[model samples]
Target: MIVPPPLRFGVLGLGRAGVSMLPALRTHPHAVVAAAADLNPTARAQFTRDFEVPAYDSAEALCASPEVGVVYIATPHQFHAEHCLLAAANGKHIVVEKPLALTLADCDTIIDAVERAGVTLIVGHTASYNPTVGAARAIIRTGELGRLRLINFAAYTPFLYRPRRPEELDSASGGGILFNQTPHQVDASRLLGGGMLKSVRATAGVWDPGRRTEGACAALLQFDDGAAASLVYSGYDHFDSLEFRVSTEDERSLSLTSHGATRRALNEGARSPDEETAMLSAMGYGGPAMRSVGPGGMGMFQVELGLAIVSCERGDLRLVADGLIIYDDEGRRSLPLRYDRGVPGRGNVFDELRSAVVDGIRPIHDARWGKATLEACLAIQQSSKEDREVYLSHQVTVGD
Candidate 1:
């Protein structure tokens, strides 16, 4: 038996996503964040103080660091492509955030760069990475559920009301739930419901004139294998779907109940956008929210995404915070999924990256897969804009 040396990682853009990814990074036995880059001196200072590693203001500098074997891209949605190209150019393995890129061409460009550079690229941490979802997929693959028939996902949160950085409220700029959040629900559907999407009919609602973005959206996804997924998302924060968490409603979930608090803090607490942005930053790693960890040191990522149910021929799987609820001919059984907050024990985007870089395994969430997910999301928006059903021609099956 042989042991692989710990893989050191460099982080780009230490925002909420980057900071929040720390716990999951620590979960892997051979993975460690060795350095980071951020424009915010405050974030960099705090990161260096907490991790005791050199933090750089320039992303290139971090990528150039010899100590970093991999790059964890936690930057905003718009910067994903550029940063990925940079990391690939530096010959560093990459873990990029979801939605791959804003457009298919950008996604292709990124794909080309990484392939040419011969560096591994994994995009993820979506609901598809959820342990319960993994459990459901495993059961579905067993053919005990007959076949995947349908998927229903609903997400409602304070996403819109949260502090904005101008682009965060604009869809054209890759803001809103369309670009930022749909990848999770859509990818989950693709993962569990069979990945060959055929078409989608949808509508988007920008009810808040102040926000001027798609605060709400609903889409019906038709799959090639007769499976379908009905997805609805609302960021207005009026109602939270996490309330429907399966089994137990642990009161510890601030994400489940933070609608009012977010509104109050945004409207009354902050005097301007700068202040609100600062407030949001303060919730990232090394900030005030850093102190709040779950039973297994799960950070803010511990929040239950939403209520997701996958209907099969003989049974249905309900995804929850604790695990999954499986109802079949044998009656209902509760499957408690424990990944220790995305530790390396179970399969996920993190471990997938590790396996791809350390070993010779291909990640499920590769660039093409990400492009397929993005295709579905774009089809959803186009379907809404055209007021008709939009068909997807670029979708691929799980292994394809």
Candidate 2:
């Protein structure tokens, strides 16, 4: 019997997103990091020391490694296309972090290259992998949500400062909250709405002088089903927020909030018994007890890698649900009434990536989905600049 080659991986770009994969990769049974590539000497050293994997000076070297069967790209917003193209050319299955590329053109370029290469190309859209998102998808898939009419998706990042450094702050580098932050919500909206975006009308503004990009953006999206989503994204506020409320024509609603305070009380040191009770009361009882639902057990990214490994091994897309099963806590799994069963306010982009990998499917936030999100973001910027309601072209493809 010919044994299949072990799916060795090389991770390119060791920033926040890149580093998060270390724990997940270490735990995966079918895949291991053969090498890692990053430009920063300190980061490279730390990654090598942490993972005991060879460290290369550049992504090109890592992709070229004979042992590497796959490449995970976690570089800054602007470098996704080049890295994926290089890795795909080198015959490596590519896993790119979300927003596929900075622009629709870049997304198309990367997609074309990956298609030509005939290798698995998956974007790291972490939101879809979220257990709550999974449960939500399952619920929606079952038509329990019943002809969704309105989706109010909001993500607020307080202390959301755009980088002051030249390399990190440029719009070309994916600096804006609308562009960088809203893709997750966009994907979620698509998931719950069950339709393509027909058009987008947006308004945005930059409240902070230091940040050239909009600190707040609101978009009104009309879907093919006549359902509409009101998306409010704020990068600067007194509070950090992540929430999605899906309401259907059947008079039922589901709200998913992945944020900070809720996770801390649930995952970290225990609070006073009274405090715990209060937390439960505030979160609303999903059932007997308040289960913490925050992002834990595996961060969003690690979950993504794990999902990919499992899916590749399984040889089918059904693993998407499998990974979700692994992550689901009662809070995450419970229906509308059980919202408080899991910890609130925690999810990582990695979760969606791994789920897609396991299921042998790409998410709505695939290259096309990313493009639509970017289009909406760009429209917001355009509208903000022109002080007019920017209307998205109907002919645009939201995602393929």
Candidate 3:
């Protein structure tokens, strides 16, 4: 078998998310980080020092480089479409971070550019790549779930409390939890429900006056097929659902050990709770030196976070640290999954892109699918603002 040369990647943005993706891009079997772009001199210097790759102070320089075959855009939410267009214009394939764009119109603009350039585009909807998420989608398709009925997903994090660039605290700039975090939940819901979204009714809260973006959101979605989903998310730094689970002994042990120490330290006034959380949030930024135990004992890789539950007709599926948990009339069972540490979820985004470029296989979550998810997210905001249900066109489908 002949092994083709790795696809050379030009990374745009050096923020926390961009920096985090560097290690994976470098380690991917079919991808390599050939160049990077960021406006921050500190970031450029650090990236060059760490990766020994040419770092540019502007995205245009990186995109124009002959070494880059693919451009990975991890810029802030407001700039996604702009960066994508630049990359497409340069005749480069693209891998964009999720929430594809701030609005459906921007998504369409990006779609137009990529289609015109005849370049492959893939959105980094990492949750959709999770093996457990894939397993849930598979179970639903098997008809064992007997027609997907409801999905209940909830997440709470110290998002708002995290260190931020000014844009991150402004909703219009795509800084809030809705644009930043809810994409995962919305994509996961769409994947499991397997239908077009019909409507959404939601409520959002902005508890902190200084941070004007929404601190919490609750939404109810109705699918065309009669399936429904409810989402509850908070970024107010109050609680972490992943750390609060009680089903497994491992969770309990972690809670008693790691969490217990933090609580004790907080009570002792060694550091304020807010300070400790900010420190924790800072860890997610910076270059990618952090590593964690991967699934199925797959060694170490960057850590990702989220929690979700899919309630179908006959059973309930939950994503756990190791894999999945299903509860039904027959009780409960745990399913362990293998991890591909090179990329998010199952690490198939690069492979999918490669297939699209090399074998003409359209990606499962192509631009249309990403646009639909973005539409759903935008509808959530509209529903909250109008205090009424917002209807959707369901413009994108599974295979279109």
Candidate 2 per-residue lDDT, tens place, 54-120, comes to 8799888998999788788877777888998999899888777776777778877887887788767
- TM-score for each model: 0.93, 0.68, 0.86
Q: List CA RMSD, all candidates.
A: 2.6, 12.2, 4.4
Global lDDT of each candidate: 0.80, 0.55, 0.75
**Which ranking of candidates, highest lDDT first?**
1, 3, 2
**Residues 149-239, candidate 1, lDDT per residue (tens digit)?**
8888888777888777878888999888888787888888898876889999999889988779898888899998888999988888788
Residue 161 C-alpha lDDT in model 1: 84
Best by TM-score: 1
True-vs-predicted CA distance for residue 102, candidate 2, Å: 1.5
Positional deviation of 78 in candidate 3, in angstroms? 1.6
Better of 2 and 3 by lDDT: 3
Candidate 2 Cα outliers beyond 4 Å, as residue runs: 1-6, 162-164, 242-333, 336-365, 387-400
Report the Cα lDDT for candidate 3. 0.75
